[model samples]
Target: MIIGTAGHIDHGKTALVGALTGVDTDRLKEEKARGITIDLGFAYLPTPAGTLGFIDVPGHERLVHTMLAGASGIDFALLVVAADDGVMPQTREHFALLDLLGIRQGLVVLTKADLADEGRRAEVEGQIEALLAGTALEGAAVVPVSVVTGEGIEDLRSRLIAAAQGFSARASEGGFRLAVDRSFTLSGAGTVVTGTVLSGRVRVGDTLKVSPSGLSARVRSIHAQNRKAEEARAGDRCALNLAGEGVTHDAITRGDMVLDPALHAPSERIDASLRVLPGEPKPLGAWFPVRLHHASVEVGARLVPLAGDGVAPGGEGPVQLVLERPIAAASGDRYVIRDTSSQRTVGGGRFLDLRAPARKRRTPERLAQLDALMETDPAASVARLLAIDPWHVDLSAFARDHALGEGAAGRLAAELGLVTFSTPGARIGLSPARWELIRAAILAELTRFHDANPDLPGMGAERLRLALAPRLARPVFTEAVKRLAGEGRLALEGAWVRLAGHEVRLTRQDELLWEMIEPRLGGVERFRPPRVRDLAGLTGVAEPEIRRLMKLLGRMGRVDEVAQDHFFRRATVAQMVAMVRQLAEAAPDRQFAAARFRDRIEQDDHSVGRKVAIQILEFFDRHGVTLRRGDLRRINPHRLDLFGAIGEDAVNSGARSSQAETVSPDEGASRQVL
Candidate 1:
C-alpha cells in the first residue's frame, strides 16, 4: 500500500516518515540545508503484510501542486498535525484535497507530543475531531507521538501495518497507465521513470506509448516496491527502465503518461460533475478560469456551468471544462481545480465525458446525457446512454474512452445482449427491442411509400435514410439494410431499398401506350430507336405522355434512356454491350475507337445514324460499362452483366428482355470511368 503524508510545513511529516522507515525523504540540498521538505520524497517499509511505500509531499502553501502530484495515486493518507501548532491553514487545505481525491483509508498523527502537556494534546485533538466531523476520515484514529522521545512510535507503526493488511488490491482489468512523476538517467540503466501504476499491468519488454506526444518506448526492466521484478501491476509504486528511439531523460517529464497505445486519444473539452468549496469567498462564475490538475498533469481551463449562470459557493452541479491544450484522460477520473492565481483551492470533481461539444451544451437533452455519464460503472452508463433517444451506442469508442482491454467491449455487449451492427470503422450496439422497433418503422415507411407512389420501383437509399427517425450514420444504415436483405425481409436492388415483395407494374392505359411505343423502339432498327417526338407522332400519343410512360418503363427496367429524348429496349442495350465486347476482343490492344464502334453498329442496321451510335457509347461510358480515354474506348470486363446476361443467343434473338427487368438502371454503377 502507498501512503502519502499531508499537513502544513514543519509539521514533522518527513520526520515521522524517517522515524518509521529510517530513511530521510528530504534528499534535496535545499531541503537538507533548510531542515524542511522542499519537493516530493520517497521511502519504503517492509512488514509482515507487504511493502508500504511512503510519498513525503511538501506542505508549504506554494507547493500544493507538487503535493497533489505525489498524492494523486496513493492508497492511503497520513494526516500529520504538529501538537505545538494545533491546526494551520495548510492543514485544512491538504485535508480537503485528500477528501476530494477520495482517499478514505487513513489515520491522523499528532507529532511533538513531548513538547506539550496532556491538556495541550487534548486541545489539539479537539481541533482534529472538528476537522474530520463530516469527512471520509470522520472516526479515524488520532495517535499522538513524539519523534524526539520515540513515544508511541511503535504503536503508530502497528496501526499502519494493520491498515495495509486490510487494504484491497486494485483490480488489474484495464489497460496499463503510469503517470510519470520522476525521470532521470542512471549510469547502468539508460533512463528510469518512477510513478504509481494507475491501472492494468506492464511487464518487461512490453511496448508503451507516451501519451499526447505519441512517442513509443519499450520497457527494459521494472522495480516494484523498490525491488526488481519482472512485471508491475496497478496500485504499486514502480520504477521502469525504458529504452527506445527518443526515450531520453529530458524527453519525458513529470506530467506525461506512459500508457497503452489504444488509450492515446487526447481531448481538450471535458464534461464533469463539479462542486465549489464552501469556504470560497464568492460563488463561481459561469465562465471561470482555473488550473485543472488530474493524475499529475496541470493545464489552464475555462469552467462553464452547464445548467445555470453560475454555481453558488458549496453548490454541486455539472460543468464543462475547456482546456487550453489536450490531455489524455478516462472516465471517472477525479480532478482538482485551483484558482488561476494558484493560491487557494476552488473545488474538485470527477470527469464524466472527455469529448464534450462546444455547442448545445446547455440543452436539456445534453444535460440528461451528462447525467447518465455520471454513473461510475461503465456498463451502467452504456445502458443509460442506449436508453436515450438515439438508442444506439458506439461500443468501440466507449471501450477506448474507458481504457478497457481487448475483448472487454465484446464481453460487455454479450452480457447486455445488444443487437449489434458492425462497419469497418465502428461497432454500434442497440437494444434488441429498439432494433425491432427500427425494423418495423422501416417496413412501415416502405409500405406507405409504395401506397403513395406505385409506379416507381422503390426509394433511393439516401432519401429513405433521411426520411427515417433517429437518423443513423451512413455506413451503419447501409449495414442494417444489408442485414435486412440477408434475412429476406427487404430487397436492396442497386441503390434502391424496398420490401421483398414490392414490384412496379404498368397501369392498363399505360400498358396500351407502351405496347405501341415498344414495337417502334424494338424492331429491325432497335439500335437507332425513335425519339419521344417521333414515337408520339407515329403512335398519335401526346409527347408528354410518351415521355412519362417511357420514364416509368425505365424505372420498371423495361428500357434505357440513352439520351435526353432517345429511348431503347433493355434487350437492345444488352445486345449493344455484347457488340462492344466483341469489337474490343477483335482489336489488337482490346481498345476500339468511336468511329470503329459506329461502323460496327452500322453493319447491324445500315440506317443506324452516327449521332445515335456516339450517344449509345457515351451512355455506356456514364454507366461504367465502358472506360474511355480521349478517342479510344475499352469494354469494362467487370460490368459485362450490368445491363443483363450477355451471350450470343441472347444478343441475336433478344431472349434476355424478361430477365433484364430484374436489373435496376442505377444498379452496379458505383465505379468511375477510367
Candidate 2:
C-alpha cells in the first residue's frame, strides 16, 4: 500500500517518515541544506502484512503541484501538523487538497511534541479536529510524535501497519497505465522511470507506449515495491528500465504515461463535474483561466461553465475544460485546477467526457449525456447513455476512453444483451428492443414507399436511412440493413433497399407505351438506340412522359444510361459485351480500337455511329467491364456479367476460335494486324 505525507512546510513530514522507516526521504541536497522538503521523496517499510511505500511530499505552498502528483495514487494519507504552529495556512490547503482528492483513510500527526506542553498539544489537536470536520478524514486518529525524543513513533508505525493490512488493492483488470513521476538515466541502465502502477500489470519484456508522445518501449527490468521483481501490478510502486528508439530520459518525463498502446488517444477538450472551493473570494466566472493538474502533468486550461453564467463559491456544476495543449486522459480520472498564477487551487473534479464538442455544449441533450457519464460504474454509464434518444452507442470509443481491456467491450455488450452492428471503422451497440424497433420502422417505410411509387424498384439506401427516426451513423445503418437482408426480412440490391416481396410492375397504359418503345431500341439498331427526344418523336409520346418512364426503367434495371440522354436495353448491353469479347479475340493482342468495334457492329447490319461506339466503351470503362489504353481497349474478363450473364454459346465459340488461332504457326503474323 502507498501512503503519502501531507502538511505545511517544516512540519517534520520528512523527519517522521525517516524515524518510522530508518531512511531519510529528503534526498535532494537543497532540501537537506534548507531543512525543508522541496520536492517529492520516497521511503518504504516492510511489515508482516506487506511493504508500505511512503511518498513524502513537499509541504511548501508553491510546490503543491508536486504534492498533488505524489498524492494522486496513494492508498492512504498522513497529515502532519507541528504542535508549536498548530494548523497553519499550508496545513489547511494541503488538507483541502486531500479532501478534494477523496483520500478517506489517513491519520493526523502533531509533531514537535517535545517542545509543546500538554496544553499546547491539546490545543493543536483541537485545531486539527476542526480542520477535518465534515471532510473525508473526519474522526481520523491524531498522534503526537517527536522524532528527536523517539516518542509516539512506535505507536504511529503500528497504526500504519494495521491500515496497510486493511487496505484493499485496486483492481488490475483494466489496461495497464502508470503516470510517470520520475524519469532519468541510470549508470548501467539506459532509461529508468518510476511511478505507482495505476491499473493492470506489467512484466519484463512487455512493450509499453509513452502516451501523448507516442513513443514505444520495451521493459528491460522492473523493481516492484522497492525490490527486484518480474512483474508489477496496480497498487505497487515500481521502477522500470525501458529501451527503444527515441525513448530517452528527457523524452519521457513526469506527466507522460506509460500505457498500453491501444489507449493512446489524447484530447484537448474535456467535460467534467467541478466544485468551486468555498474559500474562494467570489463566484467562478463563465470563462476562468487555470492551471489543470491530472496525474503528474500540469497544463493551462480555460474553464467554461456549462449550465449558467458562472458557478458560485462552494457550488458544483458541469463545466468544460479547453486545454492549451492535448493530454492523454481517460474518463473518470480526477483532476485539480489552480488559478493561472498558481497562487491558490480553484477547483477539482473527475473528467466525464474527453471528446466534448465545441458547439451547442449547453443543450439539454448534451447536459443529459454529461449526467449519465457521471456514473462511477462504466457499465452503468453505458446503459444510461444507450437509453438516450439515439438509442445506440459507439462501443469502441467508449471502451477506449475508459481504458477497458481488450474484448472488454464485447463482453460487456454480451452481458447487456445488446444487438451489435459492426463496421470496419466502429462497432455500435443498442438494446435488442431498440434493434427490433428500427427493423419495424424500416419495413413500414418500405411499405409506404411501395404504395406511393409502385413503378420504382425501391428506395435509395441513403434516403431510407435518413427517413428513419433516432438517426444512426451511416456505417451502422448500412450494417443494420445488411443484417436485415441476410435474415430475408428485406432485399438489398446494390444501393437500393426494399421489402423481400416488393417488385416493380408497370401499369397497363405504361406497358403499352413501353411496347411501342422497345422495338425501336432492339433488333439490328440495338447498338445505337435513339435518344429520348427521337424516341418521343417516333412513338408520338410526350418527351417528359418518355423520359420519366426511362428513369423508372433505369431504377428497375431494365436499361442503363450509357451516357447523358442515351439509354440502352439491359439485354442489348449484355449482347454488346459478347460482341466486344469476340472482337477483342479477333484483334491482335486481344485489344481492339473503337473504329474496329464500330466496323464489327456495321457487319451485323446495324449502322452504328462512331460517337455511339465511343460512348459504349466509356460506359464499360466506368463499370470495370473494359480497360482502355490510348486508342485501344481490351475486355475485362471478370466483369463480363456486369450487365447480365453473356450467352454461353457466344463465349464458347469465341474461345474455340482463339484456341485454333493460337495453335497455328502463323499466329504471330496474324496478330500483327487488326
Candidate 3:
C-alpha cells in the first residue's frame, strides 16, 4: 500500500509522517535549510497491514501543484489539520482535490495538540468538522497527535495501519501504466523513474514507453521499498531502472506517464470541473488565468465555468478549461486549478468530460449535468455522456474521459452495449435505446417524402444527409446510415434510400394525363417532342406533380427522357427503332434529307414531325445508332451493323424532305452539296 500526507504548511504533516515511518521527509537541501519542504520526500513503513510507502509533499502555498502530483497515486490521504490553525486555505483545497480524485478511505490527523490549549483544540476540531461537513472526510476519524513531544504519536501510527489494511487492493491483472514523478540516475545505474504503479504489473525486463515524449525504455531492475523485486504490482511505490536508446533523466520528466502502447492515446484536450479561488477577480464564467496541474505537468489555462454564470469563490462550477498545451491525463483524473497571479491555491475537481467541443460560454443545463455526474454514479454518468453527440462516439475518447485503466473501459462498453468492436481498433455501431430514437426520426422524414412524391424515387442519400442530425456530419453520418441499413429497417438502393416496401404509386388522373400525351408522334421524322411542363399546362395538372409522375415512369422503364423536360412513351421509341433498322437493311447506299423524311411519313397531324424527330434522334443516340460529322448525322454501315440501322432510317427519311437532308437512321449517308 502507498500512503501520502496532505494539509497546510506547518501543520506537522511531515512530522506526523516521520513518527509513523521513522524517516524524516525533508529531503531537499533547500527545504532543510529554509525549514520547509520544496519537493516531495519519500519514506517506507514496515506495518502489519503491508510494507506501506509514504509520500510527504510540501504543503506550502507555492508548492501545492507539486503536492497534487505527489498525491495522485496514493491509496489514502493522511489529511493533517493543525490543532491551532484549524482549517487553513491549503487544507480545504487539498480536501477538495482528494475528493475529486475519488479517494474514499482516509484518516484526518489533527496534529500539534501539545501547543494548543483544550479550548483551542476543541474550537479547531469544530472548524475542521465544518470544513469537512459535506466532503468525503465528514465521517472519517480525526486523530489528535503531538509529533513534537511524541504524545499520541503511537495512536497516529495505529490509525495509519488501520487505514492501510482497510484500503482496497489495486487491480493487478490488466495493461500496465506508471506515472513518473521523479527521474534520476544513480551512480552505477543508468537512469531510474519512480512513481506509484497505478495499474497492472511491471516486470524488470518489460518494455514501456514514456508518454507525452513517447520515449521507449527497457526496465533494467525493479525496487520495492529499497529491495529488488522480480515484478511490481499495483499500489506499490516502485523505482524502475530503465536502460535503452531513449532512456534519459531529462527525457522523462515528472508528471509524464509510462504506459502500455496499445491502450491509451496522448491528447491535449481536457474537460473538467473548476472551482474559483476566492482571490480571483470573478468566481467563474469570467476568464481567469489558471495554473493548471495534472499528471505532474503544470500548464497555463483559462478556466470558465460552462454550467452556470459564476461559481462563488471556493465554489465549484462545471467548467471547461482551454489548455495552453497538452498533457497526458485521462477522464476521472483529478486536477488542481490554482490562480497563477496570486499563487493561492484554488479548489480542484475530477474531470467529467475530456473530449468536449469548444464552448464560447457556459449554460446552466450543462452545468447541472456535470454536477450530477461529479456527485453521483460514474456508470450512469458514462451513459449520459454517450448522449452528448448524435454520431457514433470515439471509443478511445470515451476511455480517456472516464480515466479508466487498461481493459476497464472495454468492460464498461460491454456493459452499456452502445457499440461493438469488430477488431482491436475498429468500432461498429449498434442500436442502443438512445440510437433507436434517432433512427426513428430519420425514418419518419423518409416516409413523409415518399408520401408526398409517390412518382419520384424516395429521398436519395445526398438529400437524406442534409436532414440527419446536425452533429452527424459526413463520416459519422455515413457510419450511422450503414448501421441503420444493416439493422434491416431502412432500405438502401443505388443512390436512393427508402423504407422497405415503399412503392411509387400514381393517381388515376396522372395516368390519364400520360395516356393523352402518349400517341402524338406517328408520322413525322425529326425528334423534338412537347416539353412536360407545356404538356402539363395543356392537361391542367400541376407542373411539379406531373414531373414526379414522369420521373416514376422513367424509373419503371415505361418512358424515356429525351431532354431535360421531354419524355417519349416506350411504344414510340421502340417502333422508331424497328422502322429505322428495316430501312437501313433496305437502302444501304441511299442518303436522305431530314425534310424529305418528314414528307415520307406524311400524316396530317402537325405535331407528328417534331415528335417523331425527337424519338428517332433519342433512339439513335441510346443505341449508338448515329455519328455526327460537322452538322450532319451520318449513317455508316459499321454503325448500321453494330447499332442496327437507326442512322440509315434517318438518311432514307431525309432524302425526300425539303429542308437540310439529314440521313435516315437506316441509310449510310454523308452530307453532299445539292
| Cα lDDT of model 1 by residue, 422-491, tens digit | 5566777777777777778788888999899887777877888888888766765766666666666777
Task: Give the lDDT ranking, best first.
Answer: 1, 2, 3
Per-residue CA lDDT of model 3 for 504-545, tens digit only, reads 665787668777766542335234556777777777777887
Candidate 2 per-residue lDDT over residues 1-674, each given as its tens digit:
99999999999999999999988988889988989888789999999989999999999889999998898888899999999999999998898888777778999998989989999999998898899998888899999999999999999999999998888898888888998999999998889999988888899999999988899999999999999999999999989999999989999999999988888898999999998899899888767899999988899999999998888889999999999998888898889999988889888989999999999999999999999999999879888988886677887888888887677667657656666765565668777778888888888999999999887778887899999887777866766777676666776654467788998989898899999998888887888889999999999999999999888888887888999878999888877788899989888799999988888777875567788888988998998888999998998886775565463344333323322110122333222110
Better of 1 and 2 by TM-score: 2
Q: How much is the lDDT of residue 506 in candidate 2?
A: 90
Instruction: Flag clash pairs in model 2.
Output: none
- By TM-score, the candidates rank as 2, 1, 3
Most TM-score-accurate candidate: 2
List lDDT for all candidates, in order: 0.85, 0.85, 0.67
- Superposed by TM-score, candidate 2 places the C-alpha of residue 275 at a distance from the truth, in angstroms, of 0.8
**lDDT score at residue 576, model 3, on the 0-100 scale:** 50
Q: Whole-model lDDT, candidate 2?
A: 0.85
Model 2 ranges off by over 4 Å: 507-549, 562-564, 569-674
List of clashing residue pairs for candidate 1: none
The stretch of ten residues in a row with the least summed lDDT in candidate 2 is 657-666
